[model samples]
Target: MALILRDIAVARGGVPVLEGVSARIETGQALILRGPNGIGKTSLLRAVAGLQPLLEGTVEPDTGQMAYGAHADGIKAQMSVAENLRFWAGLHGTSDIDAALTAFSLDGLAGRLAATLSAGQKRRVGLARLLVTGRPIWLLDEPTVSLDTASTALFGQAVDAHLRRGGTALIATHVGCGIDAPVLDLAPYKAKPRDLAGFGGNGGFA
Candidate 1:
């Protein structure tokens, strides 16, 4: 499936950050989002994921077919690694988590409680959830945070496999995930100061 964005506008803390943004990420492809911090990369992903509304424009085919991975690990601290994957799998109407575990090299840590794992290990578990989601489009924000070089490579491989299976991804990261996709710089799309006129300084909206 192709994920299309038509002149979208996104905001941060209710204040417009990016506007007139657009992109078409076709099946089996990934698009990298590059920009300075607070430039609305996360906000754009949030808007695409339907976690927040768009300030203007549209994201095609709805967000039900998309899975989002934000900065937070989104793993349960009390659950074991395998248990965490299983939980997400169940929510997304899937049960097989073995592939997800192996993808991120979590087989050895599968039985360990999430709280006992190191930062990188938790990050792996968090990212592995994307696999079991059964959603074709991934909206990830700084997915490699706290990951070592090796783990980052593992993530790249997983993304490669997803693309091979006709999945699409939109990732925002400072470091590369080793994928051979094109980059979409958000700098030119920065919202102008005049665009904030009616927002009232309290931000804009929740």
Candidate 2:
């Protein structure tokens, strides 16, 4: 299964953000969205995840089962660490909290308030949601945000494992995460005037 984009275009605040961008990510590979700030890296990710409205174009993945994690970690501050994971997994109808926390090194903090965790700790908790839910495609925005070298390495290992298991991922990051994947920059594709009715790209590799 693959995710394909065809002649996609997007506009925000009445300005074109991405135009004619095209790429196809497959079942066992990863794709990186690289660009300067305001070039629509995050916007592109959101569009791919179906979280944002596309002005023009299309996003078609061979399958609909997916995972999307943003830079914010999206952990609820008022909830316990495990409680937060429970809430996220609940969205996917998952009930295995122990295994989920264990996989992310979060079992020890199960009862700890997520608000009391450090920035790096919180990022782990957020990433754990993806693992626990067991989605096939992962759309991650800055998966290593606020992490130290060790934490970053841990995150890297997790992603590597995910790829090894044939889970596709689309990641947006300014800082490199030691994972090897094909890269796509939006600017070159966006230089031309666009229709901005939707966003997508068409690409093929043989």
Candidate 3:
């Protein structure tokens, strides 16, 4: 399995959030985590990416082979588009950044600082980082949030290509994301809404 989460359980300050979450995502597949606001969608993605600990589960990943893009974009405002790619490319041990910059329509923004670009442009910069990782598993949280229609399509195309190349993905987003992937809704697995910080006591969405 490219990514696997089994018997996953999470609690915050003694309140349960997710329970008995299990899934296996193999190469050439995508898993879409769809849920209302809060309800641990982002938390689940974070845990899968090893950013957050799994309270009661196991996540086995192929080391140095994943990219995590959060809803916030995680772009450095002071750096230009090319500059940002250069930094991440270097960090990921990549020797090329030009192809990534061009893929995200950032060639023209190479001279402009990230702070000066619009939200969509910043998102492109953030997504461009994926090109440097060369990882097979991509963990994306609301990756299309700040993107325009064109950019969203562009991102989707990138994902499709990745899947074609035997890559895997786990995405957390409310929208369809327009990718072919199994969707796991936390609503049913989460017995009660009030079990977590983001869920109401009635097992209702946040």
**Residue 104, candidate 2: alpha-carbon lDDT:** 71
Model 1's alpha-carbon lDDT is 0.90
- Cα lDDT tens digits, model 1, 1-206, are 89999888877876789988999999999999999988999999998898887777788868889999999999999999999999999999999999999999999998999999999999999999999999999999999999999999999999999999999999999888888899999999999874545433212332
Q: How accurate is candidate 3 locally (lDDT)?
A: 0.78
Task: State the C-alpha lDDT per candidate.
Answer: 0.90, 0.77, 0.78
Candidate 2 all-Cα RMSD: 4.6
Best by lDDT: 1
lDDT of 3 by residue, 52-89 (tens): 66666677774457789887877788888888888888
Displacement of residue 206 (Cα, Å) in model 3 is 27
- Candidate with maximal TM-score: 1
Error of 3 at 185 (Å): 1.3
Q: Model 3, poorest ten-residue lDDT window?
A: 197-206
Candidate 2 similarity to native, TM-score: 0.87
Off by over 4 Å in 2: 62-64, 191-206
**Candidate 3 segments exceeding 4 Å error:** 12-14, 191-206
